[model samples]
Target: MNSNHPPTPRTLPTAAAADVPTFGCVVYISTLPDGRKKGRVANLDGIEHTAGTEREVLQRIVPVFKKRVSECLAAGDSVPWIDPILEIDPQEQKRFLPVHL
Candidate 1:
């Protein structure tokens, strides 16, 4: 085979992929009518939580996301979402998908 081209990247099994801990969920923030910022953190399983302020929402939702994941696992529910993290594997690209600032 010719060596001019780069090698094809290999795919790792979902389990085998190296996980790098990072923000796992997408938090949607908006200015409320009263000017307070509101946020909704959502995961792949359709689990979501709402809170006021970016700091507070993240603090609250991350734990809740973990709890939800645990519950989903305990019940033998297929984890619908990737574990919350930045996922450092070169195979994985980009943290959370685009979210409006």
Candidate 2:
């Protein structure tokens, strides 16, 4: 992770459906100094999952992200989307995932 350069975004695989509403989600995974991996979703505040590995963190966060999106939709609140590029930290790795709810 070079602090001088932005991390390249990687797209995660997803199953598609023409009728399902899909939203673009940016997930940032970073390694802490203490060796823990932390995952966070862009535009979503105070929601983070930390684990011993990247896969574990991601697995833990995705369901929560989906649930939040579902809740917002059911409540008639607009789900916020932010450009992941603008939120990028050079030290963190990013994943672009299509979230279907």
Candidate 3:
């Protein structure tokens, strides 16, 4: 190895790299009775966050959802992923969020 040259970066094996998982879930946003926006994960029961706006609700929920996924993976439990296609009421809005650890 030449002292003036930088070392080449090594790539991880495909399978090994894939082991570090990426999680995704569907968040459904709906207006509450009092007009606040509520963001609820489609597959995680009781996992919800509320804020004054759609953007704020999403910002609040993503971290909480990521933490839950991290905890599950740390404990060797399966993450609760949302379905590819979820049926929702017409009044609700939805978005798919990917959680990368």
Candidate 4:
């Protein structure tokens, strides 16, 4: 992998008054065409599956998230500080994300 594009660590937990971590990451998942779905955990692109069910998609994603979290902890990756993504409407997928890019 290019050093310039390392996988991002998902949102970190909130810090305590002292001796607490101040970094984190975020993961986004959405359904796709023809019973397919996709997502990103940290910077790692997720697997595409044709489960055709929301519960199946969730089942597929759990392991991906867990593995990435382990990697992030081992690497001590810093989560970028930013406003949280508050709105996630599946209907407006194109507008919600930069599909062209």
Report the poorest 10 consecutive residues by lDDT, candidate 1.
92-101
Q: Against the unseen true structure, what C-alpha lDDT does each candidate score?
A: 0.53, 0.80, 0.81, 0.46
TM-score, cand. 3 vs. native: 0.68
Q: Can you tell me which runs of candidate 2 are displaced by over 4 Å?
A: 1-18, 83-86
Put the candidates in lDDT order, highest first: 3, 2, 1, 4
Clashes of each: 3, 0, 0, 8
TM agreement with the true structure for every prediction: 0.47, 0.70, 0.68, 0.39
- Extract clashing residue pairs from model 3: none
Better of 1 and 2 by TM-score: 2
lDDT of 3 by residue, 1-101 (tens): 79998999999776644556677768899998999998888866557889999899989888888888888888999876655545677889888887777
Candidate 4 or 1, higher lDDT: 1
Best by TM-score: 2
A best-first ranking of the candidates according to their TM-score comes to: 2, 3, 1, 4
Q: Quantify how close model 4 is to the true structure by its C-alpha RMSD in Å.
A: 19.0
Pairs that collide, model 2: none
For candidate 4, the per-residue lDDT at 38 reads 54
Compared with the true structure, model 1 gives a TM-score of: 0.47
- Total residue pair clashes for candidate 2: 0
Candidate 2 local distance difference test against the native:
0.80
Q: Write the per-residue lDDT of candidate 2 for residues 1-101, one digit (tens) a residue.
A: 79999999999869664788787667888999999999888767656889999899878887888888889899999866554434768888988778778
Q: Would you list the clashing residue pairs of candidate 1?
A: 22-85, 22-86, 24-84
